[model samples]
Target chain A: MNSTLLRTSALRSALRAAAPKTSSRAGLAGTTFVRSKVTLPDLPYDYGALEPAISGKIMELHHSKHHNTYVTSFNNFSEQMAEAKHKEDIQTQIALQPLINFHGGGHINHSLFWENLAPTSKGGGEPPKGQLAKAINDNYGSLDAFKEKFNAALAGIQGSGWAWLVQDTQTGGIQIKTYANQDPVVGQFRPILGIDAWEHAYYLQYENRKAEYFKAIWDVINWQAAEKRFK
Target chain B: MSAPTYTLPPLPYAYDALEPHISAQIMELHHNKHHQTYITNLNSALRSQAEAVHASDITTQVSLQQAIKFNAGGHINHSLFWQNLAPASSVDAKSSSAPELIKQIKATWGDEESFREAFKAALLGIQGSGWGWLVKVETGKEQRLAIVTTKDQDPIVGKGETPIFGVDMWEHAYYLQYLNGKASYVENIWNVINWKTAEERFKGTRADAFRIFKASI
Candidate 1:
């Protein structure tokens, strides 16, 4: 993991402990805030590790630059949000909400994305076992069927966005979903795994060849990690 | 069963027709790639929504709100936007053409130049993806011009006001040519504003009070 991301994780834990009862996001009414600046989380693996699947250059830019901008912008928005809340500026708070969503979504989606993948050597393509496997089979017929449906959702996204395997909040049933831009399906559904269908994710290596990139991602998917989350 | 799909509204002029102000490349990509995607997604959302209604899955239907709104707004905004623009060569600035519209704008903002500035201000002041609209609204038994901005892909049609004209503030509209300079793109856009079409829209909206998006659709 990037050391900054590690620090961010540590800070998040500390913040959770520190402000367990209060809120500061979007300039909502809240108590004093313990400053929490978002930081770029390091990619868990080397850039070249996803090689034949995703080029090192793409990975580097995605993580270092793209994700980094989100982190920095998120932090800035957070600071501004805090100031607005501090001053009880309702109009300013309303204005800042979109920026918060955009940057916050980028931060969250990218952070989850880094954890969502692993190199081939580390059981990336390994299928789920036990309860997770049973659940997949029950809901989607089979793992292959799940992939087929999920990739269809991925391929159909209108613009920059992600296709996700999200557990429905109501029934805990897994469903394939897509969200445009940096939107993360975290509020009503529990996102188990996400595949970025953003052009930047594949434009470099695949160059508008989305279908090929969708197929290639299976080689680097950290199934073991995702299954652990599902269970 | 026949499906209701939103078709991309044909540009008022040729793809390269806007020229110098809005490059053919920008218009082509904006129409074909961006606007086309919105139409496709809107169709898919409406279809799935119909299925959810059939299945009695209210939760799933509710879950699709963002998709429905965003894509529907995209389709509505773009369709109106294409009609609101024309080639610079096509415009005849004869004040006699839209005397009433010009008089109303002048009354509202003191002059056309100030109205343009106010519109630009509303647009430049926007924080993220959205649209800037010049609308004819009845504030209190008086028809007046109001500058409104809607965030992301939210349409202006349902604002209880008739839209005179609107500019797509989405980055996809001008990012290639304008890059980060949205003000520049918006500034040049005025050169192609179809006063004649806007006059017709104004008259049509005045003809029927309930002529917004949902009502017309």
Candidate 2:
């Protein structure tokens, strides 16, 4: 985690350096900026490791095709945004907002989602311990009750979205929240566990039987990750 | 380079026209919110495209293609969808109202029931946000009926093809009323389908079928 944070900070510094200085037109014209591209993150486990919960084909497509599309599209739009900014083209910049939001949120959401799962051999589905377990029990009575509530929230989503178990930054209370489309959980809420309700996440394996996918996913959830986030 | 802006076409009937099969709440949101957003976005993107064209920025113009396609498709699909529905109690909703289209459907699928089943299957088979369409395809004086689907707000754009009618399979279309029972939504949508519109589209030219856009603009 520390190494990941370091790498992210380094990438940010590189991006800052690459950004054209609007005041220095001659400098910008002479120098070529080597922008740092946002690449797809490697999954912690093999695609098939989740097994009966999520199929290998589904994982492969979800990660490689769907998630990668978001990453690539986001990168493309980011480049366009930079150019638009350099040119001071406000209309073009405004038009790029939705694309940036959708693709950027997709990338962020999927990155968190991948970390929120694991294989059974690695303590996946093992109930949360310590503070996270206590928080769940304190807020929602029991783990079973919390799961039921979470699943209900998932089922209630009207369109492609995500159901997240989030901790309120100020109050420290755990709550269930749903976001439409690729909108990410941000601001006052920190997402501890996020289950994607997007059709692409489970349709290849479960098809229209999304309830089964929702139920089955709990079996492979990496509670340890949730616990870490809670702390 | 100024592009014409689009306005949301009013529903042909009241929001409650479909009743128990589809709720007024669903229709209200689907039309007023969802469909309106598409038109608004489409107009905005077109305006941006106009600016891009004026500035001779090929990259910006190219980047706006998806926004154009998605929003324009949404507008086209919803416009057609509204016209292809009537009150469940109206005479236009009956299968008997569309003799020519029914004859073609029977010829293609052997019976109306078989054709409906195939359409339902196409609707249910859509994995994500998409639409299922019953289209008229013409090939060298030979016209045929085919059921097809397009992913994520894509409208039917094939040459020599006209959408007779389409079903919005996006969860927002039925999730408020059907929840996860999409099969039930698929089964019940027939109650409000306007066969008269289907018949007209089947017998008319593609330009005639798409006359709704002209009226709106």
Candidate 3:
């Protein structure tokens, strides 16, 4: 069979296996094109909560405009893919890769970005506890050692990318990685902490001196959210 | 308006702040020349991409992919890299440390040395373009620290892991000083390791973990 037919069949099978949340069998049918819905995620805190570290304007634009564009594109891609599959079209599916990459990436990156931040008023300053703390000390000699290493790596990325604390799916251990553009973290690693380095992420507040802005962002990190995600 | 000219990010500390481990010359070049290139390229790409999209009347906006990835990644990566560094004098491991952070590391890895050895080994083992990390994992029962490696610009904390420490192994990270022998670079990078920030992260990780556990159960 053609690649389109194969992808369509695979997608159908996968959707079928999803245990359709909706009762209508129409939801499972391969005939009609049904667009998947993608909604804008609400920021957990008020727009100005991360002020000083992250300005309200940046947050407003990053979330409302930048992230919204991703959501819309993602939904469009899903609908188009669904339609292409129904029509037994493989070339179209392949062409949609960039759309999925850009929009899907935007959605995933921003979602993490929002959760990673919290108002400094909250216990955002609270540190790691128990086994997590133990591991940090043991590995780097001291927490300071880890920070130095982490920061050095963070500063090393060539351009617009993200610094992350991730879990290796293979070993179930945490690792740090950086991805450029909207590159998604593939496979087993799960992100626990992330720092956005895109210029827009800091420019207005720190100007060309990106380091100043980076230094400040840590003050508002949502450790509480990170802890929950880690668990 | 003409495109903004990108300059090298000025080092927060003197070239010798890191001293014996990372030389002043190395620091100067790394920050001033290398990082500056990334910024310049990122801005250049964005502008050209914007122009291309406008000229072609291609609403699909596909050509901007490379520009965004290359330039944007460069910008974000370097920004984090700058913040990650600090003077070694600022850290005090035994007494000045955050209690919870020290306690957690001791619980998981026995002692700081053991943890260092493991983390260092992970860093030393990178085969190609990649990084090594020490991170905290929040298990249902407790938060734990584990070490792992990754390829290219892959951020250690993407899908869900909290990154505590990372070691860069890319050629640009060490090539000027260590040349083709990455092992030497890996060994040397450790001299400038920052312990203070790692401690702060530990404090935050522990507190966060406890709160989550209590709330979940």
Candidate 4:
């Protein structure tokens, strides 16, 4: 084959090869988090794009309304906190319970929640490549097994919480964990994959049936984006 | 940036999505009630503690220390757990060759799997109400993964190393189905492992590990 043709073939092959791994990544490398004044992020895609799996109504209420409330409250809480600090009023500060965690956690988790999704047509089905694949295979014997285990683990959550696939930094292997609420994996491990088990994440579309929502969200998972998340 | 604030996070999936494995009934209670409780408690503690810290009031700070640790740790760990499990994708494909991060782990413990296995054992072995962590100690940018355990709600950040991964061993974390079967819970949690995020963390913290691994290599 001519060099140009050969190059074209190679390029096609590379693209085909890479198509799979680019789905799940949030592109945090390019996602510059400068910690500017904290504000609610506008949803990147229309709230309804995840339809059937997630309703537009839910997205609207969850994002424009719920998440925004958190952002606003977090800012207000912080401002008051600063004042509390100035006055050295320990009792008043103690009274501010719940506001900081609820709003603060709302802001953080929703930011991640928005980035975790993409439209179904955008390479959301099935994971493409890497140790994530091999690890899944090794641990569960197959991708299907991995998903089953994950879904099962997620289903097993009790009360308001989350299910996660986190890397054990000391051993550098992936491990699954669940947190009661707005807990970040930072202190114990580096977060890699997190599934929100909150009712609000699914109540509208799935009603009180979380499993249906879990099954449906797979349609728009953005696995290729996840691949890029690898270092 | 502005100290810190707390809030409830919306779910990434709809309520019924995880059915069979998880009931929508459970999810409703879990998010609105359980998770919300933590956020509320954390905020209260932070507010009170901020006041004490500003006042330089030893008695108040000391008394609230427990509250701060538990609530703050809960906030920190849960948020990280959310980001860790994105939808499954090949973009997080396993490296065919030794990823630089794996090389460092190998150098430290003879092989990557060995290090991983040891870390797993440490996490799975936790006796009760606490956490297992892998952290990188900073020695002028050189870092190494060290397994540490925290009791109740103490966070690992204050322990002098950059956190890499944290495993929760609380029964509330897995008791619905695993029910006292912590081993099964730990083992099962590995299936949807997110190597991609781990890779980002590895590369981002390379300087910390390089300083330590170079000598051993």
> Judged by DockQ, which candidate is best?
1
lDDT of 1 at A164: 85
Off by over 4 Å in 2: A1-231
TM-score of chain A of each: 0.88, 0.85, 0.81, 0.75
Question: Measured by C-alpha RMSD in angstroms, how accurate is candidate 3?
Answer: 24.9
Worst 10 residues of 4 chain A by lDDT: A14-23
What is candidate 3's local distance difference test score?
0.63
Descending-DockQ candidate ranking: 1, 2, 3, 4
Stretch of 10 with least lDDT, candidate 3 chain A: A14-23
Task: Give lDDT tens digits, candidate 3, residues B106-157.
Answer: 7888986787777777776443355676677776757677887865555544
Error of 1 at A196 (Å): 4.1
Top model number, TM-score: 1
Question: How many steric overlaps does candidate 2 have?
Answer: 0
lDDT by residue (tens digit), candidate 2, A1-231:
676456445433432332234224354575455455677777777899999999997788788877887778888998998799889999999999877778878877888888889889887899999999999999999999999999999986655789999999999999999987888777889889999998667765665567999999999999998998884
Docking class of 2: incorrect
Q: Score candidate 1 by lDDT.
A: 0.76
lDDT, model 4, position B9: 72
- Tens digits of per-residue lDDT, candidate 2, B44-136, equal 999999999999999999999988998899999999999998888999999999999999899999999999999999887664578999999
Please estimate how well model 2 matches the true structure, expressed as its whole-model Cα lDDT. Answer: 0.85
| CAPRI quality band, candidate 3 | incorrect
lDDT of 3 at A111: 77
Q: Candidate 3: misplaced stretches above 4 Å?
A: A1-35, B1-217
DockQ values, each candidate: 0.09, 0.07, 0.03, 0.02
Q: What is the C-alpha lDDT of each candidate?
A: 0.76, 0.85, 0.63, 0.60
